[model samples]
Structures are given as structure tokens and as C-alpha cells.
Target: MIGSFVLLNCKKNREKEVMMQLKKIPEIKEIQCLTGPYDILIKVESPTIEELNETITWKIRKISDVRTTYTLKINEEATDCKDDN
Candidate 1:
């Protein structure tokens, strides 16, 4: 699996509208409204890196109010929790 964390900034007060639109996309696993330089944070996942790129470029970026996006590709996972069977 491939994953990316996308930080988004929307035009004016369009965060809600953008969030609504983002929810329609299947690749977007999570969305969170933020309070900072960026307006929202999005978690996207796909079976391959190419699909991940396409989601970011074609789908997410095409939203009407989305101003800009900064994406971070996840390279590794570090966790302390383990499942007990």
C-alpha cells in the first residue's frame, strides 16, 4: 500500500465546501479541519504510488476551492502496539 498526507489550503471561507467535495473521492481515507497555515489535512491511500499521485494531482487538486496542497509520502511505519492472538 501507498499513502500520503496532504495539507490543503482553500480559498477564503471555502474549507467546508472543499471538505464536502473531498469526501466524494474514494482514495481519501481521512480528512481533518485544521487551525494554522493550512486549512485541512487529508490522508490518502492507494494500491500503488502512481494511483496515489493521480489522486493528489487529478482528483484532489481539481476541487473548486482548493488553493494549494503539500503532500508527504509515508515511507515507514513505527508502532508500539501489537495485536495479541
Candidate 2:
């Protein structure tokens, strides 16, 4: 699966609406409202990168009051744990 993180910059007074709208999209697995440069952060997973690209570009970017978005594709895992028998 392809995993990605999206940072949303919403118009003033539109954070709640934006979050609600985003939640309806099925691929958006997790979301959070944050206090920082970005108003909301979202994690999404798809079967492939192209599918993710379409969701972000077509569905997400088309929302009203969404000022802009910065997307990062998750590429690698920093660590993994295993137990030796």
C-alpha cells in the first residue's frame, strides 16, 4: 500500500468544515487538528501511488476553502523490531 501525509492550510474560520469534508473520503485513515504551520494533518493509504495521487489532486484539492496542501509520500520505515527465538 502507498502511504502519504497531507498538510492542509485552510482559510480562516474554515478548519472545522475542512476537517469534516476530508473525513468523508474513505482513503483518509487518520486525521488530526494541530497547532503549527499546518492547521490539519491527515494520513491516507491506497493500493498504489497513482491512486493516492488522484485522490489528493482531484478530490482533496477540489474542496472549497482549502487554501493549499503540502503532501509527503511515506517512503521508508526508520526502524523495526523482531524477537529472536
Candidate 3:
């Protein structure tokens, strides 16, 4: 499995709507609206890189209020699972 995080920059006054749309995407496991260079941070998992790309385009970018997105993928195995507890 591949794990990734996407940072979204949304159109002005559209954070809530964009977040709601994000929730409908199956690959996205979590999201939070925040104050920074991006408005929302999303966590996603997929079986392959291509499928992850498809989810980013078809589900994320397709949202009406989404202006841009920056994706970061996990490249190494975790040393700890304490955070999951």
C-alpha cells in the first residue's frame, strides 16, 4: 500500500464545501481545514501509484472549489506504530 497526503488550496470562501466534497472520495481517509499556504490537508491510501493519481485528478481536482493541490507520498517504512494507538 502507498500512503500520501495532499495539501489543497481552495477558492476563496469555499473551504467547507471543498472539504465536504473531499469526504466523498474513498481513497481519502482523513482531512482537516487549516490556516496556512493550503486550506485543507488530506490523508489517502491506494494500492498503486496510478490509482493514487487517478484519485487525485478524478476526485480531488474535480471538486468545484479546489484551486490547487500538492501531494506528498510516504517513501519509507515506519519505525513506530505508537501514533496509531
lDDT, candidates in the order shown: 0.95, 0.91, 0.90
- By lDDT rank, best first, the candidates go 1, 2, 3
Q: What is the C-alpha RMSD of each candidate to the true structure, in Å?
A: 2.6, 2.6, 3.1
Model 3 lDDT tens row, 51-83: 998999888998878999999987975778578
Candidate 2 per-residue lDDT, tens place, 16-80, comes to 99999998999999989989888999988999989999999988889898899999999974555
Question: Largest TM-score belongs to which candidate?
Answer: 1
TM-score of every candidate relative to the true structure:
0.91, 0.88, 0.88
Q: Is candidate 1 or candidate 2 better by TM-score?
A: 1
Stretches of candidate 1 above 4 Å error?
79-85
Best by lDDT: 1
lDDT by residue (11-83, candidate 1, tens digit) is: 9999999999999999999999999999999999999999999999999999979999999999975565687
Worst 10 residues of 1 by lDDT: 76-85
Better of 1 and 2 by lDDT: 1
